[model samples]
Each structure stands twice: as structure tokens, then as C-alpha cells.
Target: MRRFKHLFFLLLVITLVPMTSCDDDDDDVEPSRMDLLTAGEWSGFAIFVNGADVTDFLASDEDEPIDVRTWKLKFNNDGTYTIRGDGVDPSPLQGEWEFTNNEQAIILEGDSPGDTQTVEINKLTSSELFLNMTLEDEDSGTSIDGEIRFRR
Candidate 1:
């Protein structure tokens, strides 16, 4: 009986030892989501309506027609972003953005009275950024493809 009791106690310790070790390892590991995004001001030029060239949306020249479809995005280090454009009515949309698990896509949550949209980050650079968005028409249930580029 004494020997059997000792064996049971030994088995219990062995089982608990691994669990405790695993807990310690988890404490030392970093969060997976935190590693996905690089905090900074990502600005660049963007095309309109999936076009291939950069238009004069941001140009200061009076001769250039005001293209309200262009947007400039500023991603801050604090996990917030501001989107300014004339395409979607009232202009300038304020929201928070984050990279998806794979770090290849971004999810944006717009503030009050704004709809949320997920954007695919196609290309990124210090001075240039490119992305695509599919806008859905609520009344017609039609989807339109759009592209945007930004230059800092």
C-alpha cells in the first residue's frame, strides 16, 4: 500500500510539472496580433476608380479639376487613422484600423454614422501606398471596384 501511494503521488507531480512549465512559456511569449502592424504614418498617392496612373487629386494647381474621389490616409501610432476624401459625401472619415492576422489585409472601423470596410493593402512603401476597395451599392446591391494610392 505504501509503495502504491508513492507511485500515485509521483504520477501527479509529473502531470502538474508540464502544465506549470507551459504556463511559464506562455507568459514569455509575445502577442501574435501585436507583431502584425508597424506603427507609423503611412501616406502615399492613390489612383481613382482602379486606374493605373496617379491623378492630380492633391495638386494645388487651379487648372486641375477637383477630383473628389481621391483619399489620403494617415495611420497613427496610437492605432487610429484618418481618411480624408471627397468621394463619400461629408468628406473626411475618421476611424481605427488594424492589420489582419496574416498582415496582408487591413480592417477599418469607421466612427459614428460611417460604415466599416475592409481594404486589401496591395503595396506599401515609405512614400507610396496602394490599396483596393469594393464599394457596394445599398440600393442596387451592385459592387464597384475602386483603387487608391497615396504619396507622402
Candidate 2:
């Protein structure tokens, strides 16, 4: 009887041990890139055009320097975004955005057919975002590279 009791206790422990060790929170899913992008609003802090700092010149007047730091972009989970600020190009622009190239790039489409732009994502984190793009003039076929930095 004593030996039988010992065996039963050992079996019970073995069974219950795995049950207790098993994770109950299996549904805790990790956030995806879309989640990160749509989490908060982003503000533009810097802009580079052809390797030159053109942030101040974007919305600046002849006498006063306008800062691009006030530029704001908010991305929605439904593939929509809005840009608002005094110095920001396409200011007060509303657009639809989609991720491409396995989320390495973003294509933005505005109300007009010619407002399409593609930007390559250099880096994206919870706090910072860096994007590079090429702007081409349709008439002259001149292409200019640009970089924009943003922070949340």
C-alpha cells in the first residue's frame, strides 16, 4: 500500500507540473508594423533635399525663417493619413497610404492623380522614422532625392 501511494503521488505531480507550467496567456499577440505606424502622430523635424538641409526653407519667408518642425502626420489603421502644418508641403493634405515592398516603402496618393509619391523607409521605430524619396519633374524628367526625418 505504501509503495502504491508513492507511485500515485509521483504520477500526480508529473501530470500537474506540466499543467501549471503551460502558459495561459497564449493569445498575447505581438504588434505588427501597421500597429506601430498607426499608434501615434508623427512630427517632422528635419528635411534634406539633394543632401542639403532644406527644412527652414520649406515654409520660410524672405525675412522670417519658418520651421518644418511643426509638421504633423497622423496615420490611420485604415490606410489613410493626414498632414497638417504651415511649412509642410501639401499642407492640410488628406491622402490614402499603402505599404509596399514588404512594408519597406509607402505609396501616398492624394486627391489629384499627379499627387502620387513613393517613399522608401530607411528606419522605423517607436520613437523615430526616417524616409527617403525621389521627386521627379514630369516635364523635365529631372529627379531629386530627398530625406525626411520624423519623431513621435
Candidate 3:
């Protein structure tokens, strides 16, 4: 009976020692950039053009103001994205997105031939994303340099 008691105690310690010695730091490991970007849906928070605030207006129209508060832009892990809102063309914009420039930039290819856009990533965090893009104003034949900020 004493031998049995000691054997049981030894077995319990052996089993618990490995379990307690595990490196718990694995739980604190930070997520990668791709993991952060695709974690959830993001919406427009602000837009700037040529150093001017333009979040309330359409990129091509100064007379009309667009309420971008309802917009939803989602980046998926499968390299696809969808943008929907009051001002988005074709109701919802669907496209394929890819990370470029060593993951420092992003390129979006939309349905139309002229819908290709390359935007530099100004910032990317778990909750916020900022992109700098150079867009051409088709009506004015001028380039529009801007930053678009999004939040999750």
C-alpha cells in the first residue's frame, strides 16, 4: 500500500511537470501584418487629397458631399476585397488585392481595365490602416495625390 501511494504521487508529478513547464510566451506572440489586415472589416474614417480634407465629398464632385460613414471595405485572406457604400460605383466594388513592395504597398485590380490602382501603405495596425495613392481625375486630366484612412 505504501509503494502504491508513492508510485501514484510520482506519476502525478511527472505528468504535471511537463504541462507547467510549457512556454506560455506563445500566447503573447504578435500577429503578422497579413493577419492584422484581414482580421476584420474596415470602414473609411477619413480621406485627404492634395493635403486637403475631402472625406465628405466625392473625389470627382465638389458640389456634392458623400457621407462615407456607412461605407464598408473588407479585405479577405484570399486576396479579394469588397467595398460598398453610397458613393461606391456599381453599387459594390469587388476586386482582387495583393501586397507589393515587400508588403509596404497594395495593388487592387477591379473589374474594369482602368480600375487598377497601386497604393502605398502609410500605416497598418490591428485597428487602423492608412494608404497613400495617386489617382487620376478623369474629368480634369489631373493627378490626385491623397491618403485614405480606415478603421476596423
> lDDT of all predictions, in order shown?
0.63, 0.84, 0.84
Per-residue lDDT of model 1, residues 1-152, tens digit only: 99999999999999998877756655795534333234344443445664645356433435433353455567765777786654544457777888874877788888865667788877665555667878565557898776666665
lDDT string for model 3 (50-128, tens) is 7788776663465544556667889899999998886677669999999999999989999988889988999999989
Arrange candidates, best TM-score first.
3, 2, 1
User: Which clashing pairs does model 2 show?
Assistant: none
TM-score, cand. 1 vs. native: 0.54
The true-versus-predicted C-alpha distance at residue 137 of model 2, in Å, is 8.2
Distance from true location, Cα of 34 in model 2, Å: 0.5
Clashing pairs in 1: 44-150, 44-151, 45-149, 45-150, 45-151, 46-149, 46-150
Winning candidate number (TM-score): 3
lDDT of 2: 0.84
lDDT computed for candidate 1: 0.63
